[model samples]
Target chain A: MRNNDGNLVFERTPYISGYASVVGKKEGEGPLRDYYDRIIHDSYAGKDTFEQAESELMNTAVRVALNKGEFTQHDIDLACCGDLLNQCVASSFAMRSYAIPYAGVYGACSTMALSMILSATAIESGAAKRAVCAASSHYCTAERQYRFPLEYGSQRPPTAQWTVTGSGACILEKAGDSHNLLNHHTELKSNIPPSSGDDPLLKENHRESQTPYLHSARLGRIIDFQITDQNNMGAAMAPAVVKIGIKNNGIKHGIKP
Target chain B: MRNNDGNLVFERTPYISGYASVVGKKEGEGPLRDYYDRIIHDSYAGKDTFEQAESELMNTAVRVALNKGEFTQHDIDLACCGDLLNQCVASSFAMRSYAIPYAGVYGACSTMALSMILSATAIESGAAKRAVCAASSHYCTAERQYRFPLEYGSQRPPTAQWTVTGSGACILEKAGDSHNLLNHHTELKSNIPPSSGDDPLLKENHRESQTPYLHSARLGRIIDFQITDQNNMGAAMAPAVVKIGIKNNGIKHGIKP
Candidate 1:
């Protein structure tokens, strides 16, 4: 149901049963390197073009997520995907091999979040039993498309942030079904206590506490503060983030503003 | 709910309450010129750039649709929009002024159909009370981005289809609520017979017969026939459409193919 703050409260919470992340060489060298599932040392990821490389990254992420969840492509009801490309060709190309139904979304920097929300809604509304959400971006593609080409050797602005060459994907399923789906995965099965017998309720409760569930989502409105400087996108987006953060906080605390 | 054929059947039907279309000078001179709500004689539409002109076209379509339905910006729960530009900047720029929650989608040529299906799902699932779906494309933008620049005066292939410069917007609402929403519009009100009187049931049935309702939707999977020729997109896409069309036809006829 929609609250006064315009947030959607899911009646049937969606759970992230599996997830995977893949990054390029630069990001693999970062502090969060160990968190990723795979790292491609080459910028091209053995692909002919930067766009194809990005598509490969996303394809790897999706495959890894499905493997972790012990689910096949046919198990997924929908695939909500997008990327930072001229026409989001990365997602389309990556998903072409899989026969899963697809919906392509474009939200630039917010694409991953957007895809997750759409997936959660699909699961919550009974429109989908399981959905995959994925997003990808490559630094080389972004630089040449939005700025000077790498061969140009242009000077960088201090305020400009480097785009990461990476992709992440997650498999969302109905909350109640998580226990049955994740039972075969030994790592997750280890979370269940030996003393807790086959009482389904207790096991479900234990699994619920261990797994992450999406309870609600609040969609953001476009808030343009008119910061025309492309180099300082952080500053331009700050106001929008702050506005949404305040509204979300208010809704959580039951404070009307 | 999903059926054996992978189509979503909406239990609560969604209705198209209002719609509008806007086109540029070239389309205005076409045979269907009288069908459009508005036509701009200038390619720029008083905007400084072709990109901005495309945004203006989408903005006009959205406003005209909302105006016909007598809906203010606040009445819209969500706006699903996209375009042919890089990063879909045309949609983003056009939606920046409206405070309605937004979801940017990218399906290239299938964007409008994708948006409408999403809006229908949202309405049927009670995630949104009303949604505005809009899509736009400018010939100049498409030509410069995907092919040669307009100034180049490049030759065109015989198989190439010219991208029309236009925008279309539609508002989807709950089916039962359409009678109340369209009551103020005389054009639709005249559809009801004067003898119907105040019998609410008869009025509703009459309205249902006159209006269009979304019964079901089938999402398509990406199919690559590996046709590398850019000028013959129709040939590349024909197999996918035929496959989906046959499946839908089978479902309608209750065939278990």
Candidate 2:
């Protein structure tokens, strides 16, 4: 087992096999636009309110990621995820329909990283065979809760960021030795015939590609330089982000930042 | 390596070595009154605002728990804790004075349980030598955020329980076996002399009492039964709490609920 203790990086044996991103039309119009699995026409996505729409994004994103991984809902051991909602209603409400176990986390905009770290550790420690890390945020929902209501039409300050209306999910499966990054979860029996058998997905011709590995994860500690500016979250998150990036860089690539 | 996988209970070896709670005057006069270690004169705790008072309570609780454990700040690896505050500012701001790492968490009223579980798991997994699990809530802080300000004096239905202005913390130490519940952290050595030596604290006559072990921890999945009553958090939380208690009972004692 990889040592996942007493350090920033959770060096675990988890392979990120499949992923999906569901974005709003505005995000679909942006760069890296073609990469998203699906994009809805509006923020509401036919829901009555922005919160419902956010939940829809999360639910759809999970399904899309599962489809990409060729795994069904029953195959996933748990959904370790969160969002920007108070009480994390977006993820919790979406989870009521899902039969799998759930773990709701909160880390503001950095919640996805937190989810990924938790899933990796859980899977590494044999708490799960597979886990889905998901997060979502809608412009309307976040604005009204954290700042001004849509009806107020408050002007955005220069440091203000437009809350992205999008959701992303990724399936992390337990991995094995370094020589075989393609090693899947032991419990998840494979469909790949044999190393020598006729299978184009794993054939010698298609073996050039790489499996995305969770080399290590640097869990972030809370940090604040006392920037009490309510309008500028960037200032508050800057120190923590910088610390994470520096530590992760050193762990992942033997270089001290 | 006790198995903490798939099952709700984290059957780790952590003993709840120490704990501390600080509450406002109103809570001090209530049911769990005798349980808390310290009760402030007012909600503000002589601070300028309710937020500051809440932070002071958290900071004081950590110190109290540490003192009870006879461990200093440097001995703690992390503080796995949070509060009902937005962005978990109460926990984060309170932790800044201590040099140890902080893990901010949120589970509404169930935050204390979350803090305990996380600290236990981290300790069992060897991520921490010593951990402090903490949580707090002030009536004024939560009321204004989730409902009306205190000045409004909104009439409450019987079902609407008053938000307790209180904070609680616990120190979970890894237990070696059934016999070693009182064994402290490895780093916290030398303070305790041998049982056969000249220390009256560990004399045979005074060894009857046992420290309660955290036999297991069951993480509760979110269960929203479509009751969207903002004022009735008790209603929203009842299902989750019941689910947790039943599962924990089964896992810890095999009594099927």
Candidate 3:
């Protein structure tokens, strides 16, 4: 993590507080606890559409950033955020509160990661000083907008993860220690050879294995970063990740269960 | 324009079409021209907000891109667009119609330029081959949400530009050489003086000047791409054409105005 001193850089790990969520529009004792004291619940409840709710959520994130950072509107150099909306209305509406120079970005659920990436780039490029990167997924909101609604009772597979109706926001400060954004690394594992020598040359092996012989002939490829399944994100992404990682690392066998 | 055969590179020039505006509850005819056949009427009429209109307009743009580019639902690599809203609702909602992979972007009114920049980057990075970059602004919608009602008729300074309530979308294809995104040379003129020219005589001369002058005695500084008076982007952008023409071995700036 390199701080550009004048702009926001990425942070691998930083102190996090004020997490909030609007899943199912939960009213009490839920993910929105962090927002209970500061935010007005009715502010979001009165809206008729998901778009309105998204805008409200983004504004809430900005308010949180301002409060947690102990900085006023003037101190912020840029507001960077985006989501899966038609024209990035959530971000644009949120920016209305303050006149901070801004840039909106998108990358699906990967938006958070992409924001961090661009925040790092902008900081490294010295175009900004302090930046905020945030994203949200409103279940009731996203569902009605993206797929079938909750009322539709659409059957989903166990492999699929629930779409989280929540928002996450973080601030990247330029004056922090060097390890803000994690460095990009490229490395991979080697293929493991079959344990048995010459495949035993047995008549049973000659039969081409009537039984599916468990071959531990390959090592699973791994990425360096701490990998946590982002629930549905994992399954939706597993195929692509496995394909790339296995090929790049020279992993000889198929993906492990 | 160099075509790498479906490989996304940079373009040389492209035409813009299908522009429309909806200021307040009234629709403007400027955008409903040869290119535009659809008009997005607000559902709630006066109650129709910027977030909603912007989404509708962007959706129209995507539809236009789909029809004009002869692309199917799956053919679009990504949807890249953004607006002046707080949370980017416009791009997100508009993206729901097409099941194409998408990435929202924002740079305010400069959003077209910004999205174009990212589209170029995405194409160049091999992350996408075909990308659609679009942006929209709703003056009445923005005013009601951000500032005050347009009926208030507040006096704005000459430097202030009335936000145009319109949307524009462009489909960037790795196709024919005739259709390319052009690059223009940027220049800036500032009323700042050179540091090296600061001297005792210059300082005395500066004090005697009618207009505010620095000790360096310079009229202005010429920068490569910092367009000042950007409050009027159309006017400020004029010089770029001349500069680009000269740089690209086209007609020179034969006579200065």
Candidate 4:
């Protein structure tokens, strides 16, 4: 349902049934490394080109997510995916192996959020029974395409942000249907190596009531501060995020901001 | 609603309220040029870069479409746009001036159809009241990014396809809402110079009964024939098109293909 402030409150909330993530060596060494399902030690991930490596990363994530959900590509109604590459080649190439209907999306740094929102909307609207969403960005590919190549050894500005060579995918299904599926398939398997002993999905309560559900989504409007510095994308995007946050807060409290 | 064959059949159909197109000089010389609302004589479109020129083309088309629909950006619930540029920069940059919630999509040659389908689904689901969908491509931009720079004077193969420098935008609204708005605003103005004396929107019957409405949309699955020749994209894409066509025909005749 559309709210007065333009937020969409889904009467039939869609829930995330399964998810998986893969990261590069640099990201594997970070603090949140244990949360990822797989980590590739090689930058190329056995691929000749960085572009191909990114596609492989996305493909692996999608496959693992499907395995975690105990559903194959034939069960999915649609796939929404994107990447930072030109024309979103990584996503297009990765999705080619799967016969599911697809929609390619682009939102730069916010691609993950964008894909999830679209997937949720599709499920909530009864347009699809299940949807898979994925997004990826490779440091080597992004650096050369959007900035100076790594081979050039260009000096980085303090404000410049590093792009992660990583991919994440999730399977979203209707809440009611997710419960039925969980009851039918009790033997869950992790396609990738488990990062820790406390895998959340393994917990008894987690399978019962802890699966995350999407309540509502507030789409963002484009806001520009006229910042010309390409190195300072954070500044260009902060204002828009702030605007959405304030509006969301106002809506929660039933007050006009 | 989801069909047995994965096609979406909208019970509450969405109708096109307005649309406009802009083309480059080369396209203006074509036979169907009169259908376009405006044509840019300059290759750069008075912009400093070819990328910006493409963005300008898309922005102009969007504005003209809104004007024809007798609506403003505030009336739109969402904007779905995409282009051939890396990271979809053309669409992202073009949509920044508007405050409408935006979703950037990418589907290579099928971006236009993809955007329209998503928009129709959003309106049909009641997630959005109105939507604006657009797609754009520039000859110079695509030539340099995807193949070779124009300055290189590269030779073309027989199977190579020339990318058109053009943009089109359309406004979609709920079928019931469109009739109400059309009745309220009877005097519609064309934002760009009229190419011919017979403007379709100007006809009385056109406004009353001839407007187009979306009935159903079948999303496409990615298909690869393993043809690695970049110059022969038609060969790579034709098989997928034929598969969808055959499936659609079978569905129409109530026979399984």
Candidate 2 per-residue lDDT over residues A1-257, each given as its tens digit: 23234353333446676789999988999998999999997878899999999999999999898888888877777687778887687887777777666767777887887777667666544456678889999989989978888889888888787888999999887543223244432222333222212233333322444656554555566676888766787888888766756664455557776
lDDT of 4 by residue, B75-109 (tens): 89989999998888888889989888999999888
Deviation from native of the Cα of residue B188 in model 2, angstroms = 15
Write candidate 1's Cα lDDT for B97-212 as tens digits: 88888899987788998898787777655678789999999989888988878889998987788888999999987654554544433344334332223335544654655756
Question: Tens-digit lDDT track for model 4 on A87-163?
Answer: 88899899999988999999888898888888777775567878999999999998898888889999988778888
lDDT of 2 at B155: 75
Q: Per-residue alpha-carbon lDDT of model 1 for A2-84, expressed as tens digits?
A: 33456776655567888999999999999999999999999999989999999999999999999998889988989999998
Candidate 2 has what TM-score?
0.82
**Which segments of candidate 2 are over 4 A away from where they belong?**
A1-12, A176-209, A229-231, A247-253, B1-12, B176-209, B229-232, B241-244, B247-252
TM-score of chain B of each: 0.85, 0.81, 0.55, 0.85
What value does the lDDT take at residue B54 in candidate 4? 99
Docking class of 4: medium
Candidate 1 fnat reads: 0.69
Question: How does model 4 score by TM-score?
Answer: 0.87
Off by over 4 Å in 3: A1-44, A150-160, A176-236, A243-257, B1-109, B116-257
Comparison by TM-score, 2 against 3, better one: 2
Error of 4 at A47 (Å): 0.8
Per-residue lDDT over B85-135 for candidate 3, one digit per residue giving the tens place of the 0 to 100 score: 654567666665665545566555567766765554433322344667778
Clashing pairs in 1: none
